[model samples]
Each structure stands twice: as structure tokens, then as C-alpha cells.
Target: MSVQDSAETAVLVSEWRDLLARHAATACALDRELSERFGLCMSDFEVLERLAEAAEALRVQELAEKVHLSQSALSRLIGRLEKAGLVQRAMCEADRRGIYVTLSAAGDERYQAARPLHREVLARSLAGHRPAGG
Candidate 1:
């Protein structure tokens, strides 16, 4: 590659890293805020949001993928939510071995309450990063 190409690649990589750092910082701030205000962590908020968006109950494996958590970790998270009455688990009708998770009414309420906070944090974080016009 030419020197110009190398410089461009370095700049791209740096931009990517900056984007990741910004995401992490914003998520951490949101997590702390949500935990303090709603007694829910970031992961819990993510799960609740995802379930609320799904048309029907989501399988454990599928939910794990959507939330970017390992299956075992997701299972543990689901267990906590279940114990808190935020979500419920049922066996999939077609696959008796597969467990599906559905958001409970309480979970929906919690998600509704937290959604605005999530959006505000995201909007504030991204607003500073956007290009001047486009």
C-alpha cells in the first residue's frame, strides 16, 4: 500500500476505536443511571427492550444472540428477571426442549419507564459525534 493508503487506514482504525470508546462510556453512564433510578442494569434494560419488540416469545438461544450475551450468561440473566417477575419462561410448543422467554406486564412497565432514559442517553451521546450537516 502507498503511504497515503497507510495513513488513511490508520485514521479509519482510530475513528473506529473512538466510536467504540464512546459507546462504552455512554453505556456505562446509562447503566449507572438506570441502576440508580430504576434498579435495572444495562443488560436488563436491553433484554426487556428486545423482548418488548419481539412479536412473540423469543427462544433462549435467539434472545442470547440478540442481546450479545453467551447462552449460559443469558440463562442466568433470565433467571434473575424471572425471579423478579419481569419475565417468564415457557417451553416452545413445537420444540419441547426449547425454552422461550416472554416479557411480563411488569417487565413492559419497567421497559416503558426506562425507554426514555435510554433514548436520551443515546441521543445526547450521538449528537456530539454527528457531522455538521449530514
Candidate 2:
């Protein structure tokens, strides 16, 4: 690599590393607090919340897109939730091969229970950074 290009790349990488680290630290702290306060892992909380918000059961592909997860990874996560009795899976009527996932009543209750802590922590974290008009 050319010397100038190498140096620029190094600088960019360093900046990106710091940016990523800061966000990671924030997320880790929030996750730890959430777990301690509500006994919910971030992933579990995310899935439950997504399911609770849906008017109907979500297709696996739709859930994967919303959660920013690969299909396989989402499937594994759903399996865990299913085991926990927080979610139930059903065959899609129109597409027999497609799976639809729905939050169980237990899952809905858990999400509702955790909602306050989730909102409080998130708000507290972001309050300092809110734009003046927004």
C-alpha cells in the first residue's frame, strides 16, 4: 500500500474503533442493567417487544428483517424463546413452509413488565444528547 493511503486507512480504522467501542459500552451497560432489573436479555427483550407490537404473528423472514439478524440466527433465537414459553410457532396457512411466530401471553406480560425499565434506561441514556428542537 502507498504510505499516505495506509496512514489514512489507519486513522479511519482508529476513529471507527472508538465509535464502535463507545456504542458497545453504552449497550453493554444498558443490557446489564436490564438483566439485573428485569431478568431479560437484550435479545429476548427485543424479540418479545417486536412480537407484542405486531397486530398478527410475524413470519420468520419478517422478524429477521426487523431484528437485523440472519435467518439462521433468528431461527435459533426463536427456538430459545419457544423453549422459554415466551413464543409459539405455527405454520403459515397460505405458505405451509413459512413459519409464523407469535408472543405468548406470558411473553406479553414479561414485555409489559420490562417496558418501564427499558424506557427509563433508554431515555436516561439519550436525554443528554437530544437535539435542541428535536
Candidate 3:
């Protein structure tokens, strides 16, 4: 309402944006660092994490949805993971156009290796934050 109040609001908004951007950078960096440490790309890690929770296997589209990736992007990531022996794709029995992506034994090992780093990064990122006013 007042000029001072408006200025404070703007500053707060800017600070929030800056914090978000920095957090994004930190997340990307953590992913890169972990990937380098484990020889697994970020996308590859994500795919493995997803499969690790799956009871059997996941459809390619389902994987894409969980990771918020486009079909082509998911396909490329899946291809890399498959080539790395981290995952395998098979034709879906019920749907000819659908593909099922499953984690290989090697993928499970890589995922186990990468999980700790993921948790560490997440904990470090959230360490300084608290409930809005608490």
C-alpha cells in the first residue's frame, strides 16, 4: 500500500526468486557431481530410481510422466541407460506400441550407489530452511 511497504514486498519477491534460482543451480550441480562420481547421468539416475520403486516394470510413457520429460527426451535417456546396461526395454505384451522399461542387475547396483548422494544433496539443500515463519 505505502511506497515503503511496496518496496519491501518487491525486495522479498526478488529474494525468493534468487533463492529459487540458486537452489536450482545447487540441484543441478549435485546431480552432476553425483553422476560424475558414479558414472551415471542425471536422467539415468532418475530412471533407475523410478524403476527401483516399480513392482514389475514401467511403461515408457509412465516413466516420462514421473520424470516430467517429453517422450523423445525420455526415449533418448532410456537409450543411454539401456546401452550402459543399466536398464532394458521390452515390447509390452498388451500394447504393441508400448515399451516396458526395467532395471537390470547392474542398474540396481548403480542406483544403490547413487542413492546416498541423492539423499545427501537433498538434506544439505534443505538444511537452512524452516517453516515459513518458524
lDDT winner among the candidates?
Answer: 1
Residue pairs in collision within model 2: none
Determine the backbone clash count of candidate 1.
Answer: 0
Tens-digit per-residue lDDT, 75-112, candidate 3? 99899889989999999888899999999999999999
lDDT of 1 by residue, 73-126 (tens): 999999999999999999988889999999999999999999999888888877
Quote each prediction's TM-score: 0.91, 0.80, 0.82
Which is the better candidate, 1 or 3, if ranked by TM-score?
1
The Cα error of candidate 3 at residue 58, in Å, is 0.5
lDDT of candidate 3 at residue 63, scale 0 to 100: 92
Sort the candidates on TM-score, descending order. Answer: 1, 3, 2
RMSD to the true structure for each prediction, in A, is 1.8, 3.2, 2.8
Among the numbered candidates, top TM-score falls to 1
The runs of at least 3 residues in candidate 1 whose Cα sits more than 4 Å from the true structure, single-residue gaps closed, are 131-134
lDDT of 1 at 36: 88
Q: After superposition, how far is residue 106 of candidate 2 from its true place, in Å?
A: 0.3
The sequence of per-residue lDDT tens digits that candidate 2 reaches over residues 14-124 is 979976876676678668987898777777788899999999999999999998889999999899889988899999889899999999998898889988888787776
